[model samples]
Target: MSRHAWIDASAGVAGDMLLGALLDAGARLSVVQEAVDAVAGGAVRISEREVRRGGLRAWKADVSALDDQPPARTWREIRTLVTGTAHAVFERLAEAEARVHGVDVAEVHFHEVGALDAIADVVGCCAALEDLGITSVSAGPVAVGSGSVRTRHGVLPVPAPAVTELAKGWQVLAGGDGELATPTGMALLRTWAGVCEPLPPLTLDLVGVGAGGRDPAGRANVVRVLIGTRSSPIASSLAEPAMLLEANIDDLDPRLWPGVLAGLLDLGASDAWLVPILMKKGRPAHTLSVLCPPTLADPLTDRIFRDTSTLGVRRSPRDKTALDRAFVPVKVGTGQITVKIGHRDGVLVQVMPEFEDVAALARSQGRPERVVLQEAVTAARETGLVVGAPMVSVWAGRAER
Candidate 1:
């Protein structure tokens, strides 16, 4: 099953704190170290130890720079070292810093977030999520804190200017004295977290607590990450509440439909598609349909209005059912491909290779997409993920392709 992680940043959040939380939750330190090493070239080291925050035990992740005088890297230079989620998080930070400093994004230099320790924290966090097989993430309202903090630019008000820029559209508060949320923490949350709400429903698996720099009285100076799995409705008789949002557009450029649909999905829509339709007076157009969890209805509806030529959106309640699904990686020659397995009850119902993974492997090997796909399916079957085989519990360490 796909695993989800809920970040309980109600106390506060920072890069090191979040990393410690993931480590406390059972992410292998070796995996995180390897990923960080790939990005930093041994310029930093990370270690975790038990610590106390308000009498509560938590893990403290410490990242130390191996080189005393690390280069003051620019956003452009830093962009070359990271990929995937870490890259996106830094991109968000760069843009926020640029907006706050009123400079071009490429001209922004690192006095804080660009340091080796920060790079380790970001890369380590991304590696930990992959090691733990967390495919989706969400969090509660962030605590930005109050008072003032000293920085390279000067003393800034609590929350800082860059953090305020990155906090746009997210729920936040001044939960305590001093700076509670750092720019790196806010960027990581905004980039990886799909939604900012209360704890979501899931089968509880593990909980991790990461301590901050201070152990203030009366409150735990820490961040928590809760990892668990949600039962997929696809294979269940019980249906989950959902919403179907539709918009009829005849004036939008036909070429924009892909991006419009993709944007909706990125905004947490469960599914987005278009259907051929003829409106009043026989006008030919497509009906854009977005199916999502009821909680996501508002943001997705607003996105439709912004991305499409639709003036209004129609919403309706829906009961969604789907088969239980899981992902497992199989080797096709030298490349790894993830295959999606669908099951009903406890029996295997279907097995299919994820097309994107197959396509990527094909591109790297300069082979036909269809050829790589066939090889992946054959590899999956050989690995005993065939139809009618009993469904088995697999470790949640397989990262999404």
Candidate 2:
């Protein structure tokens, strides 16, 4: 079964909290320390201890710098210091800060987040995830507490500018009385989480609790992480919470439909389609629907309004399930074509030549598209790539046709 990690940020999250959680969940301390030291060039040190927040047992990670006053770093300089996933996390953090402050990414100063401790927290967390063999990560809605917080820039509102900037497209809630989610926490979540939703079906393997610095009144100051494998039959398949946006349009010109669909797809809609419908008074109309990640709902809704005649759009949360799929390249004449394979329960169930690839090969070889498609299928089967007898029969019938 494929491994997945889910971050429970109901109480909020911070860099140190994340690192501690992973450590509490059984990540090797030595592995995390080695990666942090290598990335920080011996500038930082990490330590951990068991603690209780609101009577909940957890781990608290402490990271410190060798120097009394660490030098501030630019995005480029920080990128050079970290490698692999850690580097990617910092890159995203820098981009978000640059956008919020309206400066070039290279000119964005790290300030508090640029500190050695923060660097160790980020790098160490990434290392822990790698060591735990987490293939994917998801998080619940983030909590951004109320009140003001002090920073090098002076007293800023809680959530901070960097946190707000990073959480633009995400679901965030206000809670507690102080800063809950920090810039480092938001950056790490934005970089690692593929989806922000409630927990999915999983077989519990382990749970880790990471305590925040303070235990606020009447609440647990901790972040919980649930690491496990999916329990469903299609564990390796793609299933995510999506938003379905639909609008009924009767007056728009038919010519604009294609453009609207294309625009939606370009704007990151997973799927867009039109459905014929009978409106009130028996009038003929079309229901325009776009299925996209929940984060894209608002922007895409605005696009629908701008591009269609509908005055309102209906939005609903949907669960989208898809097969585990991959592309395998096959030779067609002198050109290489990719065959799309779909698997269910680790067994290949469907295989088809990508139409675009088949058509391109047809054009280059001066042959009919059908001929090129058949040749690709034959090659796949002959190479022992065919997964099941049923698929072979289906392909054999297509070859005859």
Candidate 3:
């Protein structure tokens, strides 16, 4: 059962445009409307009109713009607005934006996002996500418009400072005129989206096209979102990665080596390994490396630097493109355990037991860890599942000589 969702920004996406898109994608308009009413802090008057984007007719979401607008906020005030909204992943995203901009959350006022309508966009999208029960969200590469537009703060460049700041690491292309991807849009995207990278493997179930406001004339201004099924069992996660953490250390203390390897794994490293290499002056130095998921990358790196003698640590994203992996329950010698198996295409490429489960069973039964480990492996092999042949071609490693 593969499931996935995709956002097509070929026409540029906006807040309201996204809401309309969700509605078109099978989101109950009534449900979305009710949620908007509550979050808008007043009666949210919504109207849907049949519009054409790049010659395709679609429903466009439009909320009445209010005259009694809130004051223009910095990234700080905008964050406070987001905080008062909800505690879902969206809230965390608002907070992250504040941290990125180096401002107090609440004081960060709304720029393009300060208006009541913008709030509608956020709440509407959030409500729709909840309604859809979407576990994963991804986007096609976005084309952030260039040039300038008149904003609450005055006339500013196309990818407004706020938008630019919002889309820090996201993949954005170029655009022709008016504000394409707004700050509110960017914040919503960065907060909930899993990856802006090329679409990963997914089994297609549905295709959704979200209509954007104002067709950019001679181009697609509609934000098209594809709602399909994920082909793998990989889960979505985050890591507070150190964007640029690196230090070339030539210091070596063999007595201090054991702690680095053992401690880092405990501290949450995807992998911690070493390579022998010659230093600048031909001195021997172990190139200690640590690979971690984004969330744990920074702290683990910091731990290595602070706890160890390393002066600094080089850090970057360590994104893992996992296969369609799953764990199956197995019983061995009156003991039951789970084994994780990785599948690519459809063939079983790898299999391993749950380390903690095996260790606990070994400890409880007062049996040697090796014996328990072997039992678990044997059980899995006897009753293990097989993946598709295509998967085997991609992931099955060569047998040992």
Candidate 4:
């Protein structure tokens, strides 16, 4: 089973604090150290110690720079040192900085965040996640502090311009005084966390509390991580929040509609389709509709604007209910075709052969597509796979295959 990590950043989140929490949560220190060493080029060392934050015990991770004055690195320079998720995190940071300064991403150079210790924190946290086999990550609403903070660019308001840019789609609050969430922390959260919401249903396994530098008077001043296996799928299947984006276009090339729909799906829209409609001036236009998760609404909306000749796009919230689905392969003559099985309450509800597979089989064997689809369905039934049949039949049929 895959493991999930839920970040409790209600207090705040920092790169060092997040790293400490993962370390406290059973990620091997050696694994984190090795990854940090590789990325930081041996210019930094990280260590963790138990500490008290508002009387709550937590792990405090400290990254110390070995070089007295390490050379300032540019976004391009840092981009070359990291790969995969770590690289993505830095890319987000660079983009945020560019947006804040109104400059090109390649021209942005590191200030405080580009330091060796910050590099260690980001790389170590990423390594710790891989070490713990955390496949998914989610975070709660973040608390970005208030008041003024002095930066290399002079005094700036709390939640720094770069941090604000990175927090585009995330939920945030002004929790307390001073800087609570740093740019590095916001970049990490925006890049790694797939969803920002309250705790979801999960079978609790491990908990780690990571302490921030200051132990303020009231709150714990720490970030908490809860690792666990996700609970029942039924909770996720019913009434999930979704978004519907629609635009009517008559000027775009007719042939581009297919590619526009395909592009939406490629960009993470759950479903994209077109509906024919007549505009006010008797212009026959197509209404492009895209269904996607709420998190993707912004990007998909932008895509609609860029891909089609639409002056306006409309968005509405929707409740989407989905079935529990599975796939099993069945023999269609000499070729094997995959069938989709939908279940509800542990009972089989629908069974259909995947059309793409059926079409491929038809073309390969010089048979009509309809004939191949029929054979695939017949093979499924012959193996005891059908609507209203026990789902156990699916497992048994797989065994035969």
Task: State TM-scores per candidate.
Answer: 0.63, 0.64, 0.56, 0.63
- The local lDDT score (0 to 100) that residue 118 gets in candidate 1 is 93
lDDT of 3 by residue, 340-375 (tens): 776543346677889899998999899998999998
Best by lDDT: 1
Candidate 2 residue lDDT tens string, 334-353? 78778787755434578787
Candidate 4, residue 348: Cα displacement in angstroms equals 23
lDDT of 4 at 50: 99
lDDT of each: 0.85, 0.82, 0.64, 0.84
Would you give me the overall lDDT of model 2? 0.82
Superposed on all Cα atoms, the candidates' RMSDs to the truth, in angstroms, are 11.4, 12.9, 15.4, 14.8
Error of 4 at 79 (Å): 0.7
Model 4 score (lDDT) = 0.84
Residue 327, model 3: Cα distance from true site in angstroms: 22
TM-score of 2: 0.64
When sorted by TM-score, best at the front, the candidate numbers are: 2, 1, 4, 3
Clashes of 2: 0
C-alpha positional error of residue 93 in candidate 3 after TM-score superposition, expressed in Å: 8.0
